[model samples]
Target: MDAQVSINDSQAVLRLGSRFDFKAHREFRDAVESLLGQAGSRNLQVDLAEVTYLDSSALGMLLMLRDKAKATNKDVALVGVKGSVKQVLDIANFSKLFSIA
Candidate 1:
C-alpha cells in the first residue's frame, strides 16, 4: 500500500491507495506531517476515494490532522470518500468534526 500526496491551489490532497492500518501508520503520519509543514496554504484535503480499508489508526490520523489544522488556523476537508472509508467516518461521526466534500 502506498500513500501519495499532492498539492493544488490552497489544498493539500492525500491519496491513499492501501489499507490504512497500523503497519503504515508511522510512514503515513510522517508523510502527512511533512506535507503539512511544507504547506503554507490554509486548506487541507484528504482524498479517500481509493481507500479500500481503514481502521482506528486511520481515524486517529484524521483527528491528528484536524487538530494540527486547527492549531495552525487552517481548514481541513475530507473528500472523495466512499465505501468502507465513508462508512467508518460516518459510524465514527467524523463528518461533524470535519468538512466533507
Candidate 2:
C-alpha cells in the first residue's frame, strides 16, 4: 500500500492506495503514528478510494488506530470508501466503529 499524509485544518488525512494487506502493516502503522503525533490534528481520516483490496490485517490495523486515537481523544474516520473495500468494511461492521464517508 502507498500511504500519503496531509494535514487539513484540524484533520490529518492519510490517503492509501493499492492493496491494503499484511505487507502494508509497517507503513500503515508508521503513518498512523505520525498523524497521531500531530498536536494540531483533532481528527484522523483514512482515505481508501484508491485501494483495490483489503484483508483482515488491514481491518485490524484500522481498529488499532481507532484505539490509539481514542486514548489521545482524537476521532478517526474512513473516507472515500467504495467498491470492494466498502463491501469488506460493511461486512466487518466498521460503520459502527468508525465514521465513514
lDDT of each: 0.81, 0.96
Model 1 spans with C-alpha error above 4 angstroms: none
**Candidate 1 per-residue C-alpha lDDT over 1-101 given as tens digits, one digit per residue, 9 for 90 to 100:** 58778877777777777688788788778777866776566787877777789999889988988888788878889888888788889999998999886
User: TM-score for each prediction?
Assistant: 0.90, 0.98
**lDDT (10s digit) by residue, model 2, range 1-101:** 89999998999999999999999999999999899999999989999999999999999999999999999999999999999999999999999999998
Q: Which candidate ranks first by lDDT, i.e. highest?
A: 2
Worst 10 residues of 2 by lDDT: 28-37
